[model samples]
Target: MIDLSSCLSESAIQISDRTSCSKNSNVSCMISPNSTPSTQNTVTCLYRTILSTRKKILITVTWSKNSLSQGLSITIGEDPSISFKVNTNPRLFRKLKGSKSLEFQGCKVEVFWDFSSARYRSVHEPEPDDGYYIFITFDSELGMFLGDKARETLQKQEKSGPRMAKFSLITRHEHFSGNSHYQTRAKFCETGAAHDILIRRSGELEGRKNSELSVSIDKKTVIRVRSLQWNFRGNQTIFLDGLLVDLMWNVHDWFCNPDSGHGVFMFRTRSGRDSRLWMEEKILHKDEKEEFSLMIFAACKNM
Candidate 1:
């Protein structure tokens, strides 16, 4: 979790609700894993769901890929040490589809996945584009469904009737290693539109003494940092889909140590309560309403 209170309050700006994005906002892309020439790619999606016991639990699905193989891991609420993982490319486990039974906080949970025919937009992406399904069940009820083959998966289940899952995506975390230019897609709010998010840093390429940072949404630049060396850590506010998005970045490592330093960027929406309060370590596990946030960790090799 990020302590965005200081960042958002220090550089908050006032913007009218009438502000609109680019006319090409209609265009959208798949929320795939980050891309890099040579590095491990990993993406984790967190969801808040309710069990039959009325207990709220957080489920995290992490997809990862490296030079060796591809992997998938599922963990319950905040603890990564205890998890159920699947290696998609194991010599002993040649099968591409399977099911697992696990217990969490005394509640029984079942996870099902199939990736034999999974498709991908790019070879470097960890998650698939289509032709797959990942489902979670609690007390014989569907708790969550992912992928494009939902209808087909439900038909094959043993349950006669399936009920909808009361779940929402709370946050997403991604890691990538490459140049300063980073691209991904996101939906600021649950009911809002998904826009293209691009972050770029350039100074050496332009023959300038100081580097600059720019953020673009839907092909339109929304935030720019003219002197990145002086202001390597900062925040800005932007309006999207009638919501206020607080964006913060810390690229201190990129300037201080260019060899093996990573940058952290965060984009969170302001709703009923401050994101800082809800993101506290204690509050994250407690029962709470839905909130969306995106966190990016970029490792710049040749900035």
Candidate 2:
């Protein structure tokens, strides 16, 4: 029974003009209003901690999928700048499963995966639900691991037991069609329950100045904005799982330029610092560590 009354205030919200785009790409993909609905590419990254050379190391596993093929990439480093990278080539058949070894800061790390029989909810999903495994071994001890068949896979590969995963899933990025309602499952916090997030825009009147935007979680309406024309960009705070969550949206393009418009929404926890700073950035800032930021893109089809 959490209430979102504080988010309706006119003076508290801040609006900005930032948009979400590929982190590793220079070309911005724009959607046209007259374009048809097509598959969208997405990337999900998991960050974890492992022991290397008796010291802690951060490892990132990124699963990416697109229309052509799907594959995974692994990066090991003490920080973002000093990292070693390896990935599976989607265009080749050998990507189903393989192993790679590399040295980072003088520490030897070996990565392995077996996705030949991985089960996925759909072809578009990059991560599988079961029937597969991914392992990262530092020196000779299993440090980071994934998949439901971890133990079995380890036994087959003759690897030792793995230390508990210190790596946490901090962020996720996705691209989806904006023409229809967009939905996804997310856990607001590390110990929070997974909720179904639904976002959609109501049709606009021919001469009306604005449209309606609705956001719901677990099938229950949480926030509704009327006269979206004036309030298309704003931020609000709500209570979820006894925690304060800061919600922000920028749908100006969605309604203002339908032919090639897209919108960005961010859900973050209020850290007693300044919510306005996060509201202005609107997207995930690499330096923010305590907050979990989930970034999603809803773009209209382009002609």
Candidate 3:
């Protein structure tokens, strides 16, 4: 395992403080080797927002794929202990469009989706780049909406239009497979720009005392760690969109199992004094403080 003791030292770095909220349970997307051959693509995002009724809630959206079909699920509530979820399985009915409705905390919530003409960049991506729309309405008002067809879909809806999304995408987790490089896109914070993040490692440094690890944002190289073998775990602060962000990573597995091991990375906003306590306590999850956190897991396979 990679040693993080030195990297986490207070003198070596200053971690931002974050406030804690409801605890979020781990949602696994791991594939079993004994299972039949099938494509496993999963992505999850957590949003913190207030409903039309002025009630705070956490919304989780998950997109996944298997050999036989693709599916999506939406969960809403203040916390996991009291949440409601809707699962849509397109493969079962062979339909690419559908809707569902339910009542939560006296509010009528409706979900609408149309993926008939969805387009994707690759098989590994569970989300469509275009030709899709997902709308979530609270009491006939739009609470959350996604995709490029939002305008067209809204024009066809009832007189009551959807409200602006009050929620902030606080956290996102994605799993992908690659050899030397892993790439993904994310918004560092609710109001920040969506950036393309790329993490690259070199094979030539496998047996050397130190390896090279480079991180890039929107194609611009931001930080590069040399002799990673000696420093596989650490944290650094970088400025993006005029906001300071704390970048943390642990890549010990890369050297331990070059072919199958996975690495973890996180991007979070810098907070005040309390943030230090959270770091010491290791409370790195969704919280009421609006301290947005994103974690990425990259699975590296042999090239």
lDDT of 3 by residue, 193-272 (tens): 77777677754546766578877766555566788888778876566655556677888777787677777777766554
Q: Which digits, one per residue and each the tens of the lDDT, describe model 2 over residues 159-269? A: 444544455555566667535466677777767788777776665633445577777666555567799877777665666654556667777676667676677777766
In candidate 3, the residue pairs with backbone N, CA or C atoms under 3 Å apart (3 or more residues apart, or in different chains) clash, namely 17-275, 18-275, 21-287, 142-162, 142-163
- Which residue window of length 10 is worst by lDDT in model 3? 19-28
Candidate 3 displacement at residue 96 in angstroms: 1.2
Poorest 10 consecutive residues by lDDT, candidate 1: 22-31
Off by over 4 Å in 2: 1-40, 46-58, 78-95, 151-160, 204-210, 255-261, 270-290
Estimate TM-scores for all models. Answer: 0.82, 0.69, 0.73
For residues 1-303, could you state the per-residue lDDT of candidate 1 as single tens digits?
454334445424534234554333333322235633333288899888876557777899999987777888999766776578887653335677999988766667788888877887677778787888888887677888888887676677647667656787877888878777777788877677778788777785233467888777876766677878777777766678877676778887777766777777887766534444234344365544535678888886832
* Stretches of model 3 off by over 4 angstroms after superposition: 1-7, 14-40, 66-68, 78-93, 151-165, 189-192, 204-210, 257-261, 271-290
- lDDT (Cα atoms) of all candidates against the true structure: 0.71, 0.60, 0.64
What TM-score quantifies how close candidate 1 is to the native fold? 0.82
Q: What's the candidate order when arranged by decreasing TM-score?
A: 1, 3, 2
